[model samples]
Target: MENSRRSSLKLFFFVIIFILLAPQALSESDECAAEANNSCNNKARALKLKIIAIVSILMTSMIGVCLPLVTQSVPALSPERSLFVIVKAFASGIILATGFMHVLPDSFDMLSSACLKDNPWHKFPFTGFVAMLSAIVTLAIDSMATSLYAKKQSPGTSGHVVPEGDREMGVEVVSGGENNNFQFHGHHHGSVAVGKDDGSKLLRKRVIAMVLELGIIVHSVVIGLGLGASNNTCTIKGLVAALCFHQMFEGMGLGGCILQAEYKLVKKVVMAFFFSVTTPFGIALGIALSTTYRENSPRALITVGLLNASSAGLLIYMALVDLLAADFMGSKMQGSIKLQIKSLAAVLLGAGGMSLMAKWA
Candidate 1:
């Protein structure tokens, strides 16, 4: 176990080092002009649009994220319901497409921009390489964190994590001492069985919430900065609307995970607050840095591209393995064919809707 833990840490560090240095290896100096001016370059109008975007995005994000949390008050939205399963599947699909169709492509575009160094940046695929490495690193963190948290929860207690086979076969095994195993069948006095099932699962959900939020925030800030620094009133007007919708959908995805974590009210409020303000804060920062910051500059392209790639990898992995796979393979979906079909349709709709938004965003 010690060897395995050490190996995981080593692999994690290696990936981090590679991610940091990959840009250097791929760096080249290629000068290209910034985007051509198409919109009225009025400082006062641009400032007004930025302020409007900041307010609009903040409100929409709060509404989208808070929607899921508030739904917990309604019995119909309970986690056990088929409707809940379908809704979550749809949210997961939105997250998946955001990673693949939105962020990953953005990273590719930035890294492959003509403003960057040509010899390495143009010759090699740094975006995919970083994204691939980022995915591996994310998986390592997920597994290791889960194992560590589980161990902490059961400190010095020696017992198997009730086998999956036993759980599925309607048997709940409670081990208190060596050779002392109690098996309970069905829901007869189900308190112990339910506790055993929920214990470890809760920890996993909390981790997913925290990591998913980080990934989403990275993308949010990058896009916000791009929008905030723009002098194009025409472009900003359209983008403000598109971005409001973008944050709303993305918030719904993050909000679903946060809701599942079953956090205390204070923690939920804090998370929601942070998600809602991140874009606005990014915009504010961009406004402050607009004079010196250029999005198409070599440094900007490399930094944002790498960050986007890393976020893409993290989001994709969490949506696929943690959110989508866990639910799709769980007992709820497995027991109902109709629910599965409905859930699949929801997934496609969610994905399609997000993909369509990407065209403008």
Candidate 2:
């Protein structure tokens, strides 16, 4: 009986030892996890400073972008004013810089980051490929949208009128009236006169403005998210100043486009609001997800990098092909080489200024 009791006591002692040691082991593991979580939380706190900086940047951006749109009420800033053309040229240059220097390079950096795998990302120029495709896609959208709008406006095969000869005479009279209207008021009106020629142009400008805004917003939000999610104080401090200037200049470009669109007051406000809020919203979202969000993580990098690449392509295409090319090649510019040279200088100035900002941003 005593021997049996001793055996039982030994078994109980072993059980007690295991039970105590098990908890201690688990507690140590829990402590390690807690330490890791605390480190993450500290990182998140640092990111909040970036969020604050971005908020300030966005506010200034909003003011800059909305300034031109709201300034239309001033006669000096109206579309017909000569200064308007110069301002537009400058804005276009800024946009050009944004695409080439800011967005495209950032895309290349992200897609080609050393942190990413080598097999596919390093093997291919994904940034350029994506950008090229995006440009092509934007062109398709631009042309198709303009064509669709034209078709809708045109009186089609469902002919309801037989006044063929009078129609030609009426069109001539309307065209003369439109010329007079342009000379006197700097605008064409009357349904027939406005509808035939200026309508399509107006529609095209509106489409361009909206699409450009989309591209800018995508970039702005992505940048804001990066700022808001980053925990690096050194990076954040420089980014704060750089981003402020970045948003201001980019905003001016978008604002110029919006001013040309001639949208209603409500629509103008809405567009300006959208442009202003995108970055702020991104920052807010970043802060909310800071716990789980990793800016350099594989998934986040790929998604944001692709988006930035696409936006850069669209902006570059629009700024070069649509805005700058059209203006430089148009009769207004061709009429005077001096004016063209002046505009070109303005463009270069704007582009140079924006490019300088990229160094810090």
Candidate 3:
């Protein structure tokens, strides 16, 4: 009877403790639920705005990028025309601005966000470093691909020897045996033909277009993801207009590259499709992942910030070195000071516009 009474007493005490803690646990759970509901509401609002922005951006991008390609039919806009050169210069300038003003800055902001740890992030300029590395990688890819193509097309050791009949085209030997001279001329013509077969400027342009598209796509998707994940109405409103203009200008830059490539209709369409849809696709993905994703969360911030930095580096490098420097230094721009100044002004205008958009976007 004594042991049974002690056991009951212990059980009674345990029950009292559980009862005392139950309200606190319930209160915490309720608070968590409220927080989650608020988050969901915010996400829902952002998702709706993102849908509209995606559609608008897609249309703007398609129109902008397709303009130059479609303009090929106009005689004045033909690749060899002066007007075309000027237009291309303007487009290159825009791309240069985008790389420097827009993408790079965004990357810096993301990587340095307070959500991330201070030890490595604040200690080192990871954004700049990543960007620098990306640029170097891009250069490596560009140079190596060009060199490989050159080697593949070279006729060294693989050139075919001409047959006697093909080599001898009826050159009668005159006073000092002009036949030998004729034979030497034939050898020179053969070498010229081989060289023509080996190298092509068209091929180089195509490679450039493909690589540029890849770089552009990286940032496009990231921007779209950001827009999609955001639930702030104030942000979305401003972003809609800024993003529309952003896509349009970027499309123009890409369009200029596509035009230079001289790709077939199918290839042109493919390139255009990629640029147009990347952002929208990113938005869609963000919508799908919104439930689990927290923009300011440590993991999310680090991943996104690093990605932006790397992409920014690539854009900056390509814009300044590959596109601007190459064209401005080329014979076309060098021959005309007026055109150079116009292009410089255009670049500044583009950079300014994009920089302003950064305030909201």
Q: Pick the candidate with the highest lDDT.
A: 1
lDDT of 2 by residue, 1-361 (tens): 3322433354345435423432222212112111123333456557667657757976888888987877889999887776777778888998999999989999999899875788799999999999999999999989997776556534542311112122323332223432421111223253333233454566677778777877787787777777666666666677788777777777877888877766655566666777777777667666656555665665666777888899899999999988899778877788888878888988999899889988788
Q: What TM-score, to 2 decimals, does candidate 1 have?
A: 0.82
The deviation in Å at residue 162 for candidate 3 is 20
lDDT of 2: 0.70
Which lDDT tens digits does candidate 1 get at residues 239-343? 888778778877887888888876656667767887898788778867876776667768778888998899899989988898888888888888989888998
Off by over 4 Å in 1: 1-32, 159-175, 178-195
> Could you give candidate 3's per-residue lDDT for residues 1-361 as a string of tens digits?
3322433344345435423432222222112121233433465677678889888988998998998888889999887776766666566666666667777787687677775668888889988888889989988977786556545533342322221122244322212332221223444454322222222454455556666777787777777777776677777789889888888887887898878765555567767887888778778766666555566665555666776777777777777877778678878789989878877777677767777777877
> Which window of 10 residues has the lowest lDDT sum in candidate 3?
25-34
lDDT of 2 at 219: 82
Which 10-residue window in model 1 sums to the lowest lDDT?
22-31
Task: Sort all candidates by TM-score, best to worst.
Answer: 1, 2, 3
**Clashing residue pairs in candidate 3, if any?**
none
| Candidate closest to the true structure, highest TM-score | 1
Q: List pairs with backbone clashes in candidate 1.
A: 28-117, 29-117
When 1 and 2 are scored with lDDT, the better candidate is 1
